[model samples]
Target: MKADVQLLITADGSHTAVNQVLNKTYHSIHGAYQESQRVYIELGLFSAFDAFPDGPIHVFEMGFGTGLNALLTAREAERQQRQIFYTTIDAYPMPPEATSQLNYDQFFGTSYLTALHESRWNEPVEVNPYFRLTKIESELQALQIDERFQLIYYDAFAPTAQPELWETEIFQQLADLLLPGGLLTTYCSRSYVQRNMRAAGFTVTKHSGPLHKRDILKAEKVR
Candidate 1:
């Protein structure tokens, strides 16, 4: 089924899409760009780079909504001169019409955003010298991933919208996919969600969230 999306201007003047069927916004209404920058880029990617410090970073993203996170990561890779292998999975990939309406490119001053959405699915595409992207179209629970990653961006819809993705079993699968000392970060810091992560054998920590949100979760595979 094709998703019906409504374009919206977030607090920071960036565009975010709302899924009409699910009644959920693809990003925070407070500020889409700010939320992605703080949650995924600062808290997740930069922290991962600090932890490892050397080697190409491998990233696994649970939801590739809006392609905002991927675009930001690609820019970061080039700015820091870091090599990143990004693998993102999305069951409902947005169509070109919806993606083209987004104004994320205005901030970066580049055509990378368009290139990212235009890149073929289920195949690796080098967005730039420092960033390689592979977008997979599959349901997270059904997909089989053989490779492990150093960082994971868990950007799925909230538990209220998709509880199955937040279950202990699902988190266990993610934990299994993380290399030792690797971490997973998400915008959700709900107690039940943290409990599920702990149940999956992850060392979970809560951190300050972006605009309007109070806390977020960072779960590590310590063992």
Candidate 2:
């Protein structure tokens, strides 16, 4: 319920997590757009979903903060005529008005994108023909979902601010909710996180670092 936690861009243009260390919005110096495109879009989504072109792909997002990624993915799925079951977990729900202020509609088109804003806190609404959004509006620990996901967007505040969410047990449970070959991507390059994912049965990989940092994580939950 606090402010949007804006960042002060450096001369080099990397955005830091002023509010929280790990969950930074974007640093212009680090090429926020580039990092996101590389970690989440290129490596995470494209690589994760490629072999399963005929799939009814399911995405599980941790810390559904700005809703930027959701809008982009939803619009892409719609364009490709793909069926997406997106389940995002967030302890604090952002006001719909704040989400509306973002330029999601400019990229995702207003008609359906507007609905996506109002979709917050609703009763598991199907935003469109291709997108089914289920927002768990409680602590992530309290969520009781048995369905596994094909892709997980591991976006959280950060280890320094909220370490419990990034612990091994939580990621392990996330792996349990995924089928073999399911992918989990995050902007974090923490060794502990990678080790935890391995403990949870993921086949971990070190990917090219984002613009801001030197490395990122892409792990697969293999059966």
Q: List the residue pairs that clash in candidate 2.
A: 12-29, 13-28, 13-29, 13-30, 14-27, 14-29, 14-30, 15-27, 148-177
In candidate 2, stretches whose alpha carbon ends up further than 4 angstroms from where it belongs are 1-32, 107-112, 120-122
- Model 1: what TM-score? 0.98
Error of 2 at 121 (Å): 2.2
Model 1 stretches with alpha carbons more than 4 Å out: none
Lowest lDDT 10-residue stretch of candidate 1: 107-116
Q: Provide the RMSD of all predictions against the true structure, rounded to 1 decimal.
A: 0.9, 3.5
TM-score of 2: 0.83
Clashes of each: 0, 9
For 1-223, candidate 2 gives per-residue lDDT tens digits of 5234444444434332233423445323455445556777777778766956776888888876656566667766777778888888776655554555554465335455566656756357777788888777778788897788889988776677788988889987788888788899888878998888888888889888765577888998776
Candidate 1 lDDT, 1-223, residue by residue in tens: 4468989999999889998878999999999999999899999999999998999999999999899999999999999999999999999988788988889889667678877888888999999999999999999988898989999999999888999999999999998889999989999999999999999999998899999999988899986
